[model samples]
Target: MSARWRLAPGERAVWLTATTLFLLVTAAWLEHQITWYLAVDQFGYLTFAHDLLAGRVYHEWAPFQWLARTIPPRTDALAQAYVYDHGRLYCRYSPGFPILLASWIGLLGDDAAHYLNLTLFLVLLSVLIAVQWRLLRSRWRALAGTVPIVVLPTSVYLWALTPTREVAAHLSAFTGLFLLLRAGGRGLAPWRTAIAGVALGYAASVRPDAILYLVPATLLVAVHLRRRRSPFGVVARIGVVGAIGVVVGLLPALAYNWTATGNPFRSTQGMELDQFLAPLPRSEPTPAGGAVGYPSPGWHGGTTSDVQGGGLRLANLPRTLPANLAFLIEAYTPALLAAVVWGGVVALMVRPLVFVTAVPYGIVALLLYSCWPRPDPRYLIGVNLLLPMLLVEGTVGTLDLVRRLAWRGRVEAARRLAFVAAAGMVLALVGAFALRPSTSFGRLAVPILLIAAGGAGMAATWPSRRVVAIVAPLLALTLTGIAVARAWDGLDRRAGFQRPQMLRARDTFRRAVEPRAIVITTEDIGRPAENIEYYSGVAHALYLTDLARWHGSVFGVALLAIQAGVRPYLLLPVSDPERPKILKQLAGVFSLETVRDIPPAQAVEYFVAAPFHRGVHLLLERITWPGFEKEKQGGPPG
Candidate 1:
């Protein structure tokens, strides 16, 4: 028999813990995949990957050679990007996520991106849990760690599923923090310091906001080394090495930005956003037959009109802060909040180093992004992943304190009272959930009742140590289950990864219509349309608004599409009243023909705007396109 067949009890227990964690993390990954939602960020990242694969930095949506022939010149680069990049532009985002995604797509193909992200999530979760286990090993700590991974916050899971830098940022930030803490305990070896510095630098590459943690973390390392009475020469050398590692990590992002946008520091996205946000004169006539003026454009995709009004200004910060804070609070669930409190308490008592590990990143993130005119939690998902670690640490520390107290034979009666109080508190939490109150009085009464019950329960029970241990585990399980249920419920309500009906319609239309033609939407089709282009394998589709500043009409757009000698299909929702007006304008300009009619059942029925069939046939016959022969042979012409 193999010697591997024998195992000690402790070895078996370790394996068991690892196996259980693996299974739980796997389940969480599966749950997120089932939802399989894509958002604007996912769309942008995936499109960028596709463009890079196609041997281009930017995807050309439509020919802009004739842009000047039709529309008046505009000085705005943002407007120019809309006309040129065709809204398939990749801007306002760090390149790390997209570049990583591109590598995955190159290996497996487009459909593989989602699966690869799921795999990444598994690896990241495993690393985080392993690190936490090393730092604080206990039943409560394990359970607390499991809670965040199992029932991730809505923002957290969404970023995890999408190919965004947030996941990478989290991985690097937490890993760096963990390494620094380890170095703090066991003297900081040169290699450990260098590796930690690289990790932090890479984190900043993933998200600029990560610098908030990196700057402070670097300082902590230097201070710790100095306090250890290391030679000044050694300290300087360490600092130099770490700084070099950081610069090495940051080189790729800086080089790519410089090459692409001609500015190593920032992309045109913010400039474009500023132009879009600024109240500019309408170059085109409005529907009422005059140029439109605006304090802010009433468009959705560009920016938040409600808050910015006309432009992003200092005044808008205060107006948007409340909503942003609310979103952040909701995203950080009550379970997590309690854990943070407990973890903070514990960190204060036993592990001062732990507070600096993950908590600072979260605080910096909260303060940094609170001023954003747009309240998107996606940008700060790294912080979301870090705060939970603190909670786990706190809970573990508290449990360890209790265990120590019990072993010392001190506060026997006090320990019994504490258990009774804890039990009563758990029961009160259950009651609060059961009778979820709408009124202020009900909210006040529930907590008041819980406090009163805990005081009364402390005076009543004298449970044994074994009983307390069993009850605690049971409570952990119950709370974890509730957390998971709430996460699922929140996901269902938000529908982040949903829009099945719209996707079904897009797929149905692709199948029913011509396979090789240009699809242009009458209005600014948002993520649903972008989803079709990236995920639905419909690369030929381009939004009409993106083609030109049509300002409220699709006349110049149709003319341009016709001039390019491609079939121009105008897509509009069947229920849209604007469809009739658009069709009439197209008829007045060019011969209108129905290429296909998508039924309301399969899709929101839409019309295909094109020249009459006979006219198109004659036009093609007279054209004698040079590429026709190669197209017939399924190859590009030389």
Candidate 2:
């Protein structure tokens, strides 16, 4: 807004140095942690690429499609993140991401799918830096103020390792800010507004509820146009064009649902809402046999959920809101928490445009998820992009506050005490890390260092001093390195935890059946992960969730499979204590033998905040009823 906001020589040097460090750290993290195949919903996106490559518009992979049609257990079977309808398997997620991934897969082969996120990460970071510079008009604040990508470790994992759609969501958000700024004071550049609307719509394809990204952008445009003295007719036309752009962008998603699920409005997500949240009638079970749960085979009972009422209700706000916030705390970096607090002032109070959208959208996003039956922290990521910008303005706000305090000529002794306390804490941290790096506190120095350095550097930059300018980015990079190191440790820790389970699942799946055999697992365990159900069918690993609603009875379905002339190996988890009782339950339907005893995780983790691992052992079993081999020559090979 003024020439005083121009970057200084020292600040330029700091921005350059920090950017270089950030790139190196990012490259290292990608190299160290990235797996070859996408996980979770990204897995479904990957599989869709196959159909796209084959030139089919709506999942006409005849072989797999045929299996779903001809298969006997069709009534109770479908892949995760997908809906099975009349002999066809449709991925529930919109294909916006899959189209991007498919292009990479087609051009460079399958491994390129994993690198898409890395590609998007770089693009997203570049967008953040560029947008922050334009917003703050200073190179130095832009980098650190953009919020170190590692400031939220969960974000690192979510963006770098989760869905590329999420990275696109963040990119669109920051880009929207730039577009709106440029579009303001204009004589109705409806195209700019329309493009921004399109970006938001595409993101919502994957995150159906991510339409909240539009709230801020729309507010800014309407307010900007009205303030510019534009006619009501012109403003209304721009609004209509923006709305049209969203509908145009969503055309693919709408077409997909119509063709794949045979219902234009139905989504697997909506189906889950009914399955997981729909309540059973209190007096008598609803016609659909109550909300489905995968109860452990008759031997033992699983968690009887303590839900009083089912589905999303306003009454649950008191309980869900606190739970969602608690989950957020567990996932966030300390630096992010501080940014949210200090930077929040800028977002909510100082900037009318920022507050107009940020407050409403953030509140809506958080509240929407808070009412969810199981709100995962990643759901809030779209709105979380605003925090970094707010942090940039927050530094300016803080500087202004400091100048005002200095003008007031406050007590010198109080200032000295504050400086001494800060110095003492810095020394204590340095001493702990340097002297005994293996101590619990030292081992956890990264987040701790991040908390101290990132919080201090962002809150008080002392822009006039060259030493402080140099030190600010040095501190920022140090915080980045600390977060990277912390994240690296987490990545390694999860790999170690998951290795045993993944390898065991892989090995068990490979040998569970003969050349043409099918294995029905308690969960969908494919080549690498259960969550990646796209590969489960290709690997011949099925799960109970398919038939979970009808009745989660494993043997009930197992008998149905046998009657239909197909035998599926049952992969189950057995409690050593309940081993005999579980076996008795299985004996009732058909004689069974435990083929393999997969061991549990070997060691417990201590330092990591969330230790990802399998605590229970699993068993691979084969049914041994009479005439089990009579249909050996039938069905496709595993």
Candidate 3:
């Protein structure tokens, strides 16, 4: 008979309380949002989700969309990412996330939809515990693996606030990989491998780049499949089954593409956004007022245009990798580099099987994001998911190595290494919290010092490595909190972190226009048309215009839309010198009226420009041609 460990009543209560507090913390970050702006990705996904619930293909074919297709001043990165194909307009985000979101919206109300982050995260943690329990068969070990994610300040908080595909993708990929781990390596569990393939395939559909993690995952699975002296035919059969499962999982995305573009092989998103392989030019500082009336290249740093090559180049791994490692260090630990390296080496030498299964996901995530042009802190969220497991595995592997060494009569050397490991923790803390880690040197030095700090103080009364397994994380959490706080100031400066003061401002602007009115925004206060549509029953397309060079032609198209029975309103910045000239041009064509002044929304909107950290005001003027309305006349605005 075998016995299993169970928690005492008080221990159970403590665990419950700890879990509740972590949930509350996550909820609070969701409410505050820490720092982020509503981008095209969020709205695009939501629109697709809405379309799915309407019982039609996830695309639109309105007359305004025709205008959008024909419009000149369209910025693919700036406005809602819509691709026009086969007479239907589709939001260019993949349908997998939207399908998941639609299901959530259908089951629960829209208000409860955000809870997907929390709920899916809970499922992921549950699955992680199950995987660890399966491997070690110890409740304490399972809890140890799960605790960092629950207790530490990881990148998951940054993701949970946004209505993107992150948490779902994370859950899907992690679930897939760990399920394979749960299957004993020596056994032939075809069902588990098939299901894992399905999950990973679904993950790839949701976030196409997520498929990169599968390379390492596949290697791990292949190693396990061959662990036993099985015939080649058996392993080949299992692999074929998994391959079939991947195809089955991809059917939904393929079906969606077929419905939207009349081709199963090509997605509407791929139609417009196939230029990622081509590198983008870094933004040079345009003067406060460029020759054009544009507001200094505008704000919103969500995609490639914002800071694609800010300091790191995707092709140059040497420079790019270190910068990314610095970022991960700032996120989790200054000791991250040391701990991960030491862990990987020890796990490889001592427990190659565990190393292949567990460590590769984090390694893949790191290398994958290193190649990403977007340097946003949120890029490492997936890596954060693996850290707890990696730390646990690494610690166990290191201990195992030390035990082996001691068995070989190297007790003194092992003890000396343990003392230095404790010293490394001290140096990591000092470098993280006490110093200004602005320079690359400062950032990389902390982890390097962790290895060779021979003279670092070690008190006789100090707790053992067993005690540090708890204390070090609590310290790392503090370091992460400080690092994130420091990074927030830069993110706010660089990323489009804003107050929903724009919402209140939009509320005032929406009251003056009908749902059918198309708002022309030259000012980048926001692309508010989507949110406007969300609140109202519908919203006409927001036709964005070039700064000063192309307004004449754009306004001509606006007049054409007016002739086609579309009401047009020009949303301009009050401080823009081009506003008066724009109004005068419009007045020559039609009777234009000032609707209201859009109050300055408290926000920090920079297009990789120097941060203003303040709000910009907007002037809303309605362009109405009574001749077009009463007499059906239109050439210019008049």
Q: Judged by lDDT, which candidate is best? A: 3
- Clash pairs, candidate 3, are 589-637, 589-638, 590-637, 590-638
Kindly report which residue pairs in candidate 2 clash with one another: 76-546
Candidate 2 RMSD to the correct structure: 8.0
User: Model 1: what TM-score?
Assistant: 0.71
After superposing all C-alphas onto the true structure, candidate 1 shows an RMSD in angstroms of: 9.6
Could you tell which candidate, 2 or 3, scores higher by lDDT? 3
Ranking of predictions according to lDDT: 3, 2, 1
Error of 2 at 555 (Å): 4.9
lDDT of each: 0.50, 0.52, 0.55
Candidate 3, superposed: residue stretches over 4 Å from native: 1-17, 28-37, 61-80, 129-154, 183-188, 261-263, 271-297, 300-322, 392-397, 407-409, 427-434, 437-510, 543-554, 601-614, 630-638
lDDT of 3: 0.55
Winner of 1 and 2 under TM-score? 2
